[model samples]
Target: MKEGRRVYGAEDDDPPGPQPGHEYVELVGGALDGQLLDVTSWAGEDREGGAMLITENGLHGPGGRADYEPRPGTPDKWDWQGDYP
Candidate 1:
């Protein structure tokens, strides 16, 4: 086990959350895949926060796809959007 790594209760090989600054890829639906991500801020009081969620395929607003939407986090928060090729 690596330092600061969070382990899932149900599965030993899985994590309950993602680590900061680490890149991860996961199979979503059909042929599209999502990435696990954590963004960092150096000016913060402590290390940056992290999240585990799917990526958005289409741009928001006019003519956007309807099948995929942002995943909600906790009770009041939500993790959404990304820029990649």
Candidate 2:
């Protein structure tokens, strides 16, 4: 039998893996519910503002991006704002 294709963010552009001082942040909702985000470069308000990460729409190609913002009172995690073109 043949293996099936991944129709998710499994092959998306992830952070440079885990590193010192660069802890991982949880990604809630959307296509990246259990994904982690690296906001090491985001400083102060920038971290609070949010981000629009590019994600090749799995199987669809040029699939747009995955929006995420820091959860209220939860700085260690980001909530998915939704996907966009």
Candidate 3:
């Protein structure tokens, strides 16, 4: 992994992103709707645990966190669970 690279959010300016062996998952619903998630170094459990995405306009409003989980049978998508403080 490159320095300063966060393997959570998929939008990056880094060159040759989504490198070989890495995967990008499309998000559904919530504040980060339609955005892709980076799971390059994630294991099966990591993917299952999902991620708490930080956002200013998440389900709980400004400065809240967006909860997203993997969609069953879909290896390239994450469904929004909700958001919280």
Q: Which prediction has the highest TM-score against the true structure?
A: 3
True-structure RMSD for candidate 3: 5.3
Compared with the true structure, what per-residue lDDT tens digits does model 1 show for residues 1-85? 1344332221466555556465332223321333322323322222123232322444443333323223333311223334223
Supply candidate 1's per-residue lDDT for 7: 23
Residue-level lDDT of model 3, residues 1-76, one tens digit each, is 3333334444557644445566778778988886667776688788888888888887577779988888888857
Sum up the clashes in candidate 3.
Answer: 0
* lDDT digits (tens) for residues 1-85 of candidate 2: 0123222333456433354575457777876666666566667888888777777652224757888888999877789887887
lDDT of each: 0.32, 0.65, 0.73
- Higher-scoring candidate on lDDT, 1 or 3: 3
Q: Which stretches of candidate 1 lie over 4 Å from their true place?
A: 1-15, 30-85
True-structure lDDT of candidate 1: 0.32
lDDT winner between 1 and 2, please give it: 2
